[model samples]
Target: MFYSNSWTKCLICLIFIASGNAECPKPQVEGNVVLTNEALLMNDFPEGKEATFQCANGYLKEQGSERITCTSGKWSTLELTCKKKDCGAPREKPHLKYEFSEEGTLFGASARAICDKGYQLTGPSYRQCYATGWSGRPRCDVVTCDKPPEIMNGTITEKPGEEFPEYGGVIHYSCNEGYTLIGNKSIECNEDGEYNSLPPECKDVNDIPLKPTATISITTTSSSTVPPTIRDVNDIPLKPTATISITTSSTVPPTIRDVNDIPLKPTATISITTSSTVPPTIRVSGRNNCVGEHDTKSATENAAVVGIVISTVIVALIVLFILYHSYKRKGSYQMGEDPSRTKELLQFQNN
Candidate 1:
């Protein structure tokens, strides 16, 4: 029991020593401040609290606190800085338009850039701070085109066939009637400023007259007259008026009668009578000349001309065939022989 009590007392003493007021240890550095350890620890200043960093003869300090302090058994953060070695300047991007406060700043800073009106922007807008320095350079990008195609006296349904920011895009062109297309219907715009095909044109359509044929008919009238008899002088006419009045009648001649019982009629008759009648006149209807009529006339004339041509060709073929047959017949006659006489003579000769 005495040994057990002694052990318990020893344990309590150790606890008291561990909990006593020991001072925090200070950090230590030997070379460039930038290379020094970032964190620190303390042991109640058992080895005495202190921290220090020294640059090489030609180098300088950069970020972080240069010296650290210890209080309440804990050490303050160490001061860290970098000295420039004899290295050349860092790589700079030529095309990027940006502003930087320093060649190299601590991590997590930003850079800004501006693009021309026609061009667009892209890529990371800022640089990140890294152990070596700033990381990730800013970049700029050219904007895509939105301009339309310009047509000469014509129009396109779309300016550029489609939105083409990257490469070859197509467009179409068309012309109105009475004008002919002279070039390609579509063209493609290339990055090189050249269009894929040539421009188009409009031309007048050709007008040609069709074959003509003529038609004629009586369009007017003319008249003629026969002479009439004149009366004698006054004395004889007065005597006749005192004693006589005249009447006249005329009848047409009868046609020949058939043997079958048919009525016989007088050949001709004439009588004197007083009457008057206007002479019978003749009239005619003329052809029409309206627009519809004129068009129909033209069509008819064309049809007649076509028919005449076809008939003429047929007649010519017939005549040629007749002539050819006549020639062949004449040729065959020139080589003809009498087969019957030859056969009779052969039989007689053989007998």
Candidate 2:
């Protein structure tokens, strides 16, 4: 009974002491369990230590802490969170209208910008997939290639088609009918992306006159009016006329008596010629003078004797010429009615 009573006294004293001493307990939350709709959560964080948060899906996290607690046994009621938002960077905007490769998730994907129909892109078309999207905005620029017109011989007033950039494509050339091309017929894009080279030229060849033949010519003689006579072998002259005669011998009667006077009778036929009754003998000349001329008549007896003598002499000369020519040729002398022989004899006699 004494032990039991002492134990009861001690238990009452212990209860009073426990009841008087206040108690501090371990933290109620355990492990890393995230609270609802919170980017970051930390308990009993030191004064200088900090925490960061990030959102999932199409949302982006902000800097700084989402929530914090102290060891003073008091929890923070800041309720701040990393809100999902779009924070564009350098190329995030575009000067010209742009389109992304992906719509909501394009923040990390490449984006391309294109100018409108009449516009062109001034900067790079491709943009990098970045954490803060693209950097600078893309710009659209106007392009014009006002190339000069190409002509072979005519004027190059303006360029053909529309106006494009300086470095354009090829241009064609042509020439007029009488003209011909002497330069490049086509030009193309160059190093500066432009066309160059001089324009084409047109030229003509001079006409040549025909030459004349060498045989065609005119010559002036000593007398301008004296004509030339051109003839063949068919023309000759006519023959000439000549005169000739014959000779004879006969006895003449006694001179005619006057009408009233009596005529003397002829002497008795020269009866007295027989005076010397001896027989008469004639001698022939050695040469045949009969073939030539030996007899003669008194110039007073025959008035026509002169002409007859001349004709006889001419005949004798012709006969002698014939004899000489015949003796030289066939050794025989003869006469005929040929006038050429007579003319030849006459020419010889005259010579």
Candidate 3:
């Protein structure tokens, strides 16, 4: 009896399926469209029933109706068309530029933020487009550097009101008096927000290397009958009572002399006095000392030049005096011969 009942139900289902009275499978449409919530909840759609559709999450309907009908256990042709949603260009920001993906600004597309030269990106580097809009806000900030490093005995020459230096900006450095700069005088801010090189050092001038020292020695002698005071090159006075004597031996006997009918021996005495204080030693240690030594040497060279000039002048004067005397003698001899010649001419005419 149960097999008879099952056979009867199967016969009825076959009759219904043959008559095209069965429900339609889940309705589907092309172009990224999906069934509406009401339609999706229903497990099946009967013939002659309607199903509504809408664009997918990141898609938008372009044209055609969102409703379709099922007939003969099959869905009707869908006239709906959809396209990707567009987010358009990103917001504008200073020093910020945007580069879009291959999909452009459409739905699911991404954009990357780029900063101008000497600038840094502060926010997220990438943004994605969605049905709502772009993802995040990105910004570009100017690159800056902190205050330059300080140097010993040196100072930075900053602008009037500048506290922090920007990228590519330059700062100059200077040393105090009597100090020498040992590195670059100016450093520039780099793209990394730091100085291009380390700060220079200010070293004392005395620390600089010095050339070899030179020593000079000089000797002088003098003989005089009278007691005389002597002075050094600096004009410092010397003792007046010091005496110096020199003796020489000759092959010939010394000549005797008589003064007022009294015979006397040829005896000579000489005295020479020199400064007692020794000359101060000159030490060339630093730049100032070397300059002083150079000045002294120049002074000595100038004095020597002046002495040569004076000697030349004296020699010229002596030559002029001799020439004058010889000219006068020639003129006198010529004058004396003219009178004698006139007397002889008178005697010849009378003959």
Candidate 4:
């Protein structure tokens, strides 16, 4: 029983000693201070027990006691003085916006960067303010582009072709007749001063199918005629003859249906009136100056003919007037000479 009692008393003493019953230890250095992240929850500390201390972010210890001892169950007042740690303001970036986690730009503070709309970020999005400087230096810039370049033998399929090609603008290309596209058909203007793809080329067409031709030889010595056979480019004779009608002068090959991105044959039709006949008209010598299919008159020639007819009418009127005047004068003279001669004549006849 006595041994059990003694053992219990020894266990109680160990617990009490572990509960800060000893005197606080002296400071390691008189005035030097060291920063710590540990927390202090107890109001009183036993002798030989120390409490750690540290300077807040953006500040450094100029001088002071890092740890204090609980001498007589009481700690000495803090002698440490914290000085500000200054890092220059975050690197200036034009057109860039920033959001800081803390109000102060002191050490250990962090900031986030965001570029303006239509602009792209070049570096890290978040940066921390260090004692030396900012963690990442970010910048903002405007990406611009001039009018889209012209492509040879090809046209831009974009509607209302824009004069200025801005970032992310897309342009589609297509080759002209008798040419084939050789590269990317669509390209986009990128952030950098460049395009997503090299402009396509319009290569000359070379693989078109060749039409068939037949040769006939007429020999006087041969007694029988030999029929010529029609064949295709592959030298294969086609059977079951088919006939098709066309009016246009164009001879472009028909494109395959849904194959090779080819185009279809033109479906245009032209109608001619059967009863129309050629009209009589004077032809201009220098050029085919006929303005319309129905207009038969030439303004220049019509004016000249009108002037000649008017001149003829005027000359005929003048000639008729002069003839009437001469005939009247002759009749008047005959009237004046008559009477005296009449009497003498009558007398001579009677005798």
Query: Higher-lDDT candidate among 1 and 4?
Result: 4
On lDDT, the candidate that comes out on top is: 3
Best by TM-score: 3
Q: What are the per-residue Cα lDDT tens digits for candidate 2 across 226-280?
A: 2222121111111222222222223334343421122233322211111111122
Note the Cα lDDT for every prediction shown.
0.50, 0.45, 0.73, 0.61
Q: How accurate is candidate 4 locally (lDDT)?
A: 0.61
- lDDT tens digits, residue span 1-351, model 3: 999999999999999887676678887556598889898888878878899999898998899998888888788888888999999998798889999999999999999999999999988999999999999898988788888788999898763245788888888899998887877888888888888898888888666554333222233444444422322223322233444444333233334342112223333333333434233333322323333445555656787898999999999999999988996665442444677786785577568
Q: Rank the candidates by TM-score, best first.
A: 3, 4, 2, 1
Off by over 4 Å in 3: 1-22, 159-163, 210-351
Q: Who is ahead in TM-score, 2 or 4?
A: 4
TM-score (C-alpha, index-matched) for candidate 2: 0.28
Alpha-carbon runs more than 4 Å astray in model 1: 1-39, 47-94, 102-109, 128-132, 135-137, 146-351
TM-score of each: 0.26, 0.28, 0.51, 0.29
lDDT over C-alpha atoms for residue 143 of model 3: 88
Single out the weakest 10-residue window by summed lDDT for candidate 4: 229-238
Question: 312 in model 3: Cα distance from truth in Å?
Answer: 64
> Candidate 2, which segments miss by more than 4 Å at Cα?
1-65, 71-84, 87-99, 103-106, 115-121, 128-133, 140-152, 160-351
Residue 173's C-alpha lDDT in candidate 3? 92
* 73-106 per-residue lDDT for model 1 (tens digits): 6667655666654323235554455555464343
